[model samples]
Target: MSDIARELNLNPSEELDLLTKWLGRESTEHVRRIRSVHVANPALGLQLVWERLEESYGSPEVIERALFVRLENFPKFSNKDPQKLRELGDLLTELNSAKSEGYLPGLSYLDTTRGVNPIVEKLPYSLQEKWLAKGSQYKEQHYVSFPPFAYFTDFICGEARRRNDPSFSLTPTPSKTSIQYPKYEQPERAMRNVKRHISTHKTDVDVNRWTSQSDCSSFKPDDIGKQCPIHQKPHPLKKCRGFRSKPLEERKAFLKENGICFKCCSSTTHLAKNCKVALKCSECDSEDHVAALHPGPPPWGTENKNSPSQYGGEGEGPGSAVTSRCTEVCSRGQSFRSCSKICLVKVYPKAHPDRATNVYILLDDQSNRSLARSEFFDLFQIKGSHSPYTLRTCAGVTETSGRRATGFIAESLDGKMNVMLPTLIECNHMPDNRSEIPTPEVAQHHGHLKSIAHMIPCLDPDAQILVLLGRDVLQVHKVREQRNGPHSAPYAQRLDLGWVVVGNVCLGSAHKPTTVATYRTSVLENGRPSLLTPCPNQLQVKERFSSKIQNATSLRSVRHDSSVFDDCNLGNTIFQSTKDDDQISSSTAPKQSGTSTQ
Candidate 1:
C-alpha cells in the first residue's frame, strides 16, 4: 500500500492511499467483497477512512484530499450504496472549512436515474450561497448533464439529514404495543391478519419505493387497456352480447321492407319524430329519411327571377310583359318611319337650290385671243363683268348662266389654293340633291383671286405674263379689233397679267351656237326651238367648231376659221367631213352634232 501510495503521489499514512492500494489489487473476488462490505456499511466505512486520514496527515489536509478523491470516484460508488452520498456531503462541508493550498475544486456528481431536487436546502445558508456561486462558475467550465446532478445533490442533502438524525433509519420500525390473540380463534384470525398484513405491506412498499425512485424509473400501470375490476372483463361495453346480436344493415333492410325508416321504423316511409337517429336538413325544413342532410338553400326555388325569357312563367305576375316593354323603351330611343319619297320630295327639295345649266369657255392669252359663247345658247358673259347673264337651249329651255364668275380666296396667310374638282364642289353645295350643278354661291365661295395669285408665284417669275378669260366673262374683257382701219381698239391691252389656261372642257353633242331666239326661249313651255333656220352664207353661218389650235404656228395666230355650212344635209358625207376636221385639228374637240336644220 505504501509503495502504491508513493507511486500515486498519495501520503503513505493517508486513508485514501490505503483504499486506492486495496482497490488496485488484481483479484476480482477480493475487490467485490470489499465493495459489498462498503455497500452494507457505507457510513461506517467512510468514518473509518476519515479517522485514519486524521491520524496520518492531520485533519485539514486529510479532509481536503478526501473531498477530491470522493468526488472523483462518485460516479462509481453512488449507486452501490445510497448512504455514500450522505458521507460525501459531510466530507465536502468539512473540507470547505479547512485550510487549503488553492481554491477547492468544484465537485459535480451526476445520478443518471434521478430527477432534480433541492439538496442544497439541507446545507448551511452561507455554504449554500458559496457553492451555488461556485456551481455557476463550474457549470461554465464543465459540460455536466443537467437535472441528474441537481437530483443527486438533493438526495445527498436529504440523506445527510437522515444520517444526522437519531430517529431516522434505513430499517423498518416495529409497533410499540400488541394486542393478545384469542387462543381458540388464533389460527383463523392469523390467516385473516396475514392476508391483511400482506396487502398493507405491499402498498407501503410501493409508496416507499415510489418516493425514492426518480421520475425516469417510476412505475405506471394505468397505461394498460380498460378493465372491469368487478367482473374481470376486458372491453366490457363493446363485448356486450345484445349489441352484437343484430347487424346495422339487417335492421335497415327489415325496416325499409315495411316502408319505414331504419332509425325509428314508423310509417310514412320515414323515421318517427321521436327517433334519435333522424337527421334534419339545415338547407330546408324537410328531414333526410335515407341520407345525410345537405347544407345549402333548396335548389328549386332559388333561381334569379329577373331574367328576360323567364319573366312570363310560373312565378310571373300579370302585366309583366308591358312593364318589360316599357323598360326597353326607356333604355332605347324612340323609333320613326323611313320612306324614300319623303326624303326626296320634302327633305331634298327644301334643302337644295334649283339646278341650273353649265357653261365652259376656251381662251389663248399669249395671242390675246379668246372664243366666247354659251354652250347651249349664243349668249355670252366675259371676264371683269359685275353682272351675270342667261342662256337658252334649242329645246326652249332657258337657264341663267355666268362665267365661272367667282374667284377663290385664300384663308391662310400662305395663300394656298384649294382647286377642288367640279364634282366634289357640287356635291358639297347640294348635299341633299342628286343631280350635279355648279351654283353661283359654290363658284364664288371656291374661286378666290388670292389663291390664283399664289399659283402665279409657282410659275417662273421672269417669264412673260399671259391672261386667259373664260367665255362666260370673255365679252367684258374682249379685245375688239377693226377689220380694215388703223384706228381700231388695240386687239388686247398689253398687261402683266399672271394667268394661264391649264386645262380643256368637253361640250356634248347637243351643244350649238347661241341665238337671240334661243336665248329668250323656255324649253319647259315650248319643248322646241322657235327658230330652226340654218345659215346659207359664210357671214350668216352659225356652226359648231372645234376650239383647238394645231402647233405653235396656229397658236400664235389669234383667230382662224375652218368652214361654215348648212346643217340640212345628213349622210355619211357629213359624218366623213366632221371626222376629217377632227383629225386635222390638234385639239380634243367636242363630240358629234345632235342639232338639225328645218
Candidate 2:
C-alpha cells in the first residue's frame, strides 16, 4: 500500500514550486503522475490531492456530498472571492439543500441507490455504484473509452462472490465417471528440475557441503584394524557384505539408529556419499518436503504472518519481512591495514541510522573495552564507581577487570543487545577478519561462564579475548560498515565530520570542495550547490603562451612587458583586462594603440 501524504494547508501551485526546488525534478515528475481532478481544477494542496485520488469509484452524488464537507469545514472569511462564494452556494443547492424528492438531507447517501445501470441487478447496490464510478474514471482519463458495465457486473457478482466463498465455483460440478491421471517424475529429471528451482531461492549463506559423514571413523593405514564406529565392524568396512545386502530402507534406518555416518554409512569407514533417507514431513510422514518449509500459516490466527507466502518464500527485498520496526542500513568502512586501528561509527538510539550521528565507536585493541574509551563508561553510566563483581580472564588476570563492566542495551553494529557496563575491562585481540556471532544467538548464562572452558578460542593463540554475545547486548563482530568503502566520493558524502579532527589540510580542505555532477533530481543536504562552471580553456592557453614568451625574452635579457608577445603570431588580438565593471560592458575593449598580444 502507498503511504498517504500528510495534510497541508498550502495551495497546489505553491507546493509544486517548493517541492520542485526542494525535492527536485524527480519529485515533480511523480507529482505529474498524480491523477487528481483537484490538482489542475481547484488546485488543492498536494496532500489533499493525493487523498482525493484515493476516493473510491462513485457517481456525481459522491462529489456532491464531498462538496458539502468542504463547505462545512470552511471558516467565515472577510472579502473572499465572490465567484468562489457563489460556486459554494450553487454546490449546496445542487446537493439538495432544499431536500428534493430524490435527495437525502445534509448529503447522506443510501447504499441501495443505483443511478442508471441495470446490468448490476445481481450485484450489491454499493458495488454497482462503484462499478459505474470506475467507468467514469476510465472515461475521464482516456479520450476514447467504453463503459465496462458487463465486466463490472460479472466481477461484482461472480469473481468476488467466488473469492468470498471458495466453494462457489461458476463451473458445473464434474460427474463421478471422470478419472484423473497420476503424474510421475523420473529420478534424473526430478533432480534437474530441482536445480532450476534452486536458482530463484536467494539466500545469504552458501552450503559448504551437500552431505556430512561425521560419524565415520578414520581410514588411515595405521588404524586399519580399528573397530567401525557405526556397525562396530573393522575400519575400511567397504568389504562388509552383510551391510551391503540390506534393503535401502532398512539400511537407512540401521544407519540412522546406530549413529553410523548416514552419508557413507560407515561405522568405522571412509566418507563422501549421499543419504537415501529422503526428508519426511513431520505432519504427514510423507517423503516430499520438510515441515518447516510447508506452505501457509498455522491454522491459528491470521495476524501471525511470520510464515512465508504459499508461493514466494522470503528474500524478496525484505518487502514483507515483519515490517513493524525500522531496520536502517549501516554501511561498512574499509579495513585500515596497520596505520590506523580505528573504525569510525555514529549510532543513534532514538532515531534512524541515517539521522545525524555524533556518537562514535572506534577500534583500539590496545585498550580494553571494544567501543569507547575506559572513561566513556564512567562518564555515561557511572559516577566514578565500579561494580562489586570483579571480572577474571582465562589466565586469571584481573588487573584491568572492574567489578561492574557496565554496558548499555541498544541496537548496535551487531544488533540490539547490552554492550555497556559500569566499568570496562581490557579485552583480548583477534584478526582483522572474524565471524559474526549468529544474530539470533542469545547470551549464554553468565553465571555458568567462569573460566577458559566457557570461552570460544581465538584462531590466533596469542590474541585470546573474551568475546561476548547476547540478545540484551549484541556481540561485537568486525564491523564491515566500512567494507569496500571510504574510497568513493559519494560514500564519503554520507559522513558528518563534526567530531573528526584533521590537522592536515590534505585530509580535508579548510574550505569545502565545490559540488559537481549535480542534476535536477539532486537532494540538498548540507548546503546549496552552485551550478558547475566550465573551465576557461582560452584564458589558460593565453596565460601559458604569455609565460613561455616572457621566459624566452627574459633569457635573451629583454625587459619589456609589452614585447613578450612580439614574436608570437595571432589570428586576432585578445582584449586587455579592465578592473572597472562599467568599462567591461557590451563587448571587448577597442583595440589599443599597438598591442600584439592575442
Candidate 3:
C-alpha cells in the first residue's frame, strides 16, 4: 500500500519549482507546461494544477524519473457525490495531521484496523455500513490486507468491490478436478544438480573467507592464531579438537606447562590471581577460571565475582576494565575521515571586531555543546575563565580544564540571521589535509547540485575551522529547504548560514580517501552529560601561584645581605624572623614576676 497518510503541504508552484530546480536538463513538454502554469500563478494548490494537466499528459512519469519524486495524492472517486467526498477528505486530513503530530499512533500490520475504526465511526451511518461490508468481503477473499487508511482510500477509489474478485486476490483458487504428473525414475540428474549447487556455494564461501582474512591481516599472529596451540596446525586454538577433548585436570596441567593464565586461558604474561583481564566462567559466573574448564556442579542464583555488587554497588569493581580519562591541551592532525556538514560564517570577536573573518563551521547534531580551536582564542585575544569539562569521543574520554570564551558573535553570509554565542569550549584543530571539507567545484560536478552550486563558496585552502556548532546552537543549522537526488548522490541543504552540500560527492578514485574514518564527540557523565564548571578553590590557588611566579620572574637582579653571612640564606631568614619575634615578646613582658610576689 502507498503512504497516503504522509502530509504534503507544498503548494503547486513550489512543487513545480522542486521538480525543475533539481531535475536539471530533463524538462519535457508536460513539465514545461506545468512550469508555465507555475510561473503564471504561483499560489495555486497542488490538486488544481494536477487536475488540469493529468488528463492531457498521463501520470508525468518522465518528470518523476528526472526528479526521483513520489507524490501520493488522495485517490479519486466516482459515483459518490461531492459533499460526502469532501467530508471523507477532511476526515483523512484530520487523521493524517494527528498521526504526524504524534497525537495518534501509527498503523501496524498485526492489527491495521485498530486506530482507524473509531475515526471512521464518526462518518455517516450509511458510509460506515458500506465500509464495513467491503472490509468483510476483503477479509474473506485476500490473505494479505491493506492498512486501514489504504483500505479506506481503495474504497473511495471503487477498488474495494473489484479487489474481492478472484483475479485480484493473491490466494490460490480451489481445483475443480484432480490431475497427476509422471515422476522421473533416474536419481543421477537430481544428485548431479545438488552437487553443482554445493560446489558453487563452497566457492562463494571460500571467497568470503579470503576477504575476511585480508581485512584482518593487521591482527596479531597470536591473536588471530596462525597455528593451533595443541597440534601446531594452521588454525585457531579454539578450533583444535585435541585441546577441547582434554579433561579438566589435563587442561590445567597443559596451561601450567605452557605458562598461560587460567582465567583468560590465552594470556601467558600473568597468573590467574594477578590477571587484570575481565573474564568470567559462563557456567559458574566465577572470575577465577576460564569457562572451558568447568567443574561438575551447576550453581544457581550465584552472583558474578566481578559484579559491582561485590564493591558496594557504587561503580565498576577493581577487576572491571575501564576507559581511563586524561586531560589534553590541544589535539592536532586528528582526521575526521568522513564527509562533514560545513557552512561558511563570519565570526566577530568582541575584542577585535576588525579581525572578523569567514570561518568554516562544522555542524554536528550528535554533539551537545559547541567547541572552537584553542588557536582561535589567541587570534582574537579572547580571554575567559577556566572551566573543567569531560569530553567523550570515539577514541575515549578526555578531561580538560579549558578556557570557555564568550562575547563572540556569528552571522550568516547573507546577514539574515545572527547569534550571540554565550560560551565556546576550546577543543582542537582540524586535520592538516582537511579533505573532508566539501567544495563547490566537486558539488557542481553532480547534475543534481548544478543549480545551487553558486550558493556554496569556493574552496579557501587557508581557511581553518574556528568553531564547531553542536546541538546547543542548532537554531543556526535548522534546515529551511533542501534539494536532493538518488542514493549516494550529493544533496544541498539550506541552513540559516546558506546552502551546504553533503554526502559522497567524490565521483572518482583520485578524490576518494584510502581509508574510511568516523568520529563522534559528546559530553557524557554516568551515561548522561554534566555541565562544565570551574572549581573555586583550584582557581584561587592557581591565581595565587601564577601571581607569585610572575613577580619572581620579573626581577632583573638578585643580591644577598652581606651582614647576614648565612650559606642557607632563604632558610636562615625565616629562622631569624622567628627568633627576633621571640626576643621582642620577652623584652615587652614588664615586671610580671615582681607583681606575682605581692
Best by lDDT: 3
Q: What CA RMSD would candidate 1 show?
A: 53.8
Writing each residue's lDDT as its tens digit, candidate 3 over 169-230 gives: 56545442211111212223223213221111211112111122121212232342344343
Q: For residues 477-586, what per-residue lDDT tens digits would candidate 1 score against the true structure?
A: 24332111122111112112212211101111122323231232432222454543433452544344333422224322423234422422343124423324546545
Candidate with more favorable, higher lDDT: 1 or 2: 2
Q: What is the TM-score of each candidate against the true structure?
A: 0.15, 0.16, 0.30
Candidate 1 regions with alpha-carbon error over 4 angstroms: 1-69, 76-82, 97-159, 163-598
Q: Judge candidate 1 at residue 389 and give its lDDT.
A: 37
Q: Per-model C-alpha lDDT, please?
A: 0.30, 0.33, 0.53
Instruction: Please give the range of 10 consecutive residues that has the lowest summed lDDT in model 3.
Output: 323-332
What candidate 2 gets wrong by more than 4 Å, as runs, is 1-279, 282-545, 548-560, 567-573, 577-598
Q: Rank the candidates by TM-score, best first.
A: 3, 2, 1
